[model samples]
Target: MTIPDRPLEIIWDITYACPLRCVHCYSESGRRPSRQLRRDDLLRMADAIVAMRPYGISIAGGEPLLVKELFEVTERMTAAGIQVALFTGGWTLRPEMVGDLARAFFRVSVSLDGATAEVHDRVRGRRGSFDRALRALDMLAGAGPVFGIDCVVVRSNFGQIEQVCTELVPRFPGLGFVSFGAVVPEGLASRTGFAEHELLTEEQMAAMGAPAFRERLRALVPPGVHVTATDNLALQMHPDRIREGQFFPALQIEPDGAVRAMPAYEGTVGNLLTDSPAELWRRSVERWHDPFVVATLTPVRTVREWAEATRRIDYHFASAADRERIDRRPAFAQL
Candidate 1:
């Protein structure tokens, strides 16, 4: 299919402040400052997205439940006839909020990286997060809309993908899809200290995305439910589009309002705070032909390579200067 004028889906990371510190966190969320746009600024961003009018928009963050205006923004988008969804770590997701959340969101995903608390807590660097996630899911299970879990396939949890699907599928009647994200080497997973023990080999990642393996896992769940294994590197290749010279990468709106082509890389297209989303959406159509993008993606084959490839690209501020310093200082080090 050809690239649409509006992105099929948009992922907006509203804040970097999180409660848990996962080893494979793409944003190093809790470790970084929560560069939240003020309440009015956030509503303005929502207005901008409404104007862009994408098919769907996912509201994500360190923990979206932490943002007091989470539902307000979601309600605005929903009122504008846009499909709004939220992906949360479930740290502060309350039972009271689940009813309204189920009503407003197109899909509600709570992360459960592992089936058991022991494995999950270890990977997430928090003692009681597993239970909290489960409790949140329980509240949301039959509340309304499409409810599901997001499990990142990692070194320690590689074997548990099927187990998570089978166990979770029958448990939550409202559950729709289980996404097995092959952890890309970016953010915290790219940190020098984390690169060695935490990352899974390329072979292991491929095994899950393989068609036969995914089909087998899908059989373990009900027929209506879907299971998918996605490695972001494969997405960078834009496998389904069949186009040449240009690709429509996953559009991500960072907490500071920058619109990044792919969340795994720092290269940005524009910032909503500085430019209209409509204007930035127009620019995104031609971003694939840039010499830097072409050269960077030409040799990328694996998730780890994706991390190495982006280091050489010169990230820019098409709308405004960068908002934060990526530091190696002791105080600013990875958590």
Candidate 2:
């Protein structure tokens, strides 16, 4: 499928230098060693993305908060009337920092692996990350801007999803949503952690491979609260919602200003600093047919026409359980 003319969201991975070294990090490429994007280069890319007029922009990173000029980025995006969302582990959400974040954007998303401190801290590989994340959440609560939490479901935290919904929803009643990204078989995640039982098994896949899993997930979340599953998980588990009326949704721009159709693609769509939004859109549409990307994006195409027409690409699923559920949906019945 071609890239949407109007983007639902754009993700900016401003830097890759995170404080805590989580085992499942997708940006593991940064952990080895990295340099931050220059201020001028980042500002230029922001201008290009604003020109696209996307509904929202998400600035994330090893931790976006670590970047010195992140405030400028958020200020600029908001000044342009583009809604902005910041994705971070929330380890840095100190009182002073929370005030700063509240002024810069429309929403702030803090990562939480588990509802309790024990599960969260262990997953994040830091002593006090969970406490800090909650502190951040507390700091942001009832501030003008919306607040949300993001987490990656791994074998370690898979069974805790329900608890998270139950505990977090009421604790932070103003929280707008919970965002979940199932483990992607890439970067550091592919390497370490878990036995098969700990992971999503074929049986779980078969049992949960339908909309019921997501619906149940919705039920567990606080009433009226929203939820998002990024990447392939969104493809298999959330396609119906995306199609029903949600939105085209997020994109990712790397430090080099390359706009990926999604954050994980990591290849060049076009340099946001130099190219016009229309040009980048055209280029992404062109590249969508590349055997590689087509296969990656294939799981989202339900109709035979879509599948036959699609060539190559990869997809994201939130968990083995989510993928199993996704595979079982009746989307392909007509196909």
lDDT of each: 0.74, 0.64
Cα TM-score of candidate 1: 0.87
**What's the TM for model 2?**
0.75
Q: Indicate which candidate wins on TM-score.
A: 1
Instruction: Compare the candidates by lDDT and give the number of the best one.
Output: 1
Give the per-residue lDDT of model 2 (tens digit) for 242-305.
3454334456676667666544433456667777777776665455445555454445433222
lDDT of 1 at 256: 77
Estimate the overall C-alpha local distance difference test score of candidate 2. Answer: 0.64
Alpha-carbon deviation at 320 in model 1, angstroms? 12
lDDT of 1 by residue, 78-168 (tens): 9999888889888788878977897689888889999889888888879999999888888887788787888887778888888897786
- Which regions of candidate 2 are displaced past 4 Å? 1-3, 191-199, 202-211, 214-224, 227-231, 234-250, 295-335
lDDT of 1: 0.74
State the displacement of the C-alpha of residue 62, model 1, in Å, after optimal TM-score superposition: 1.3
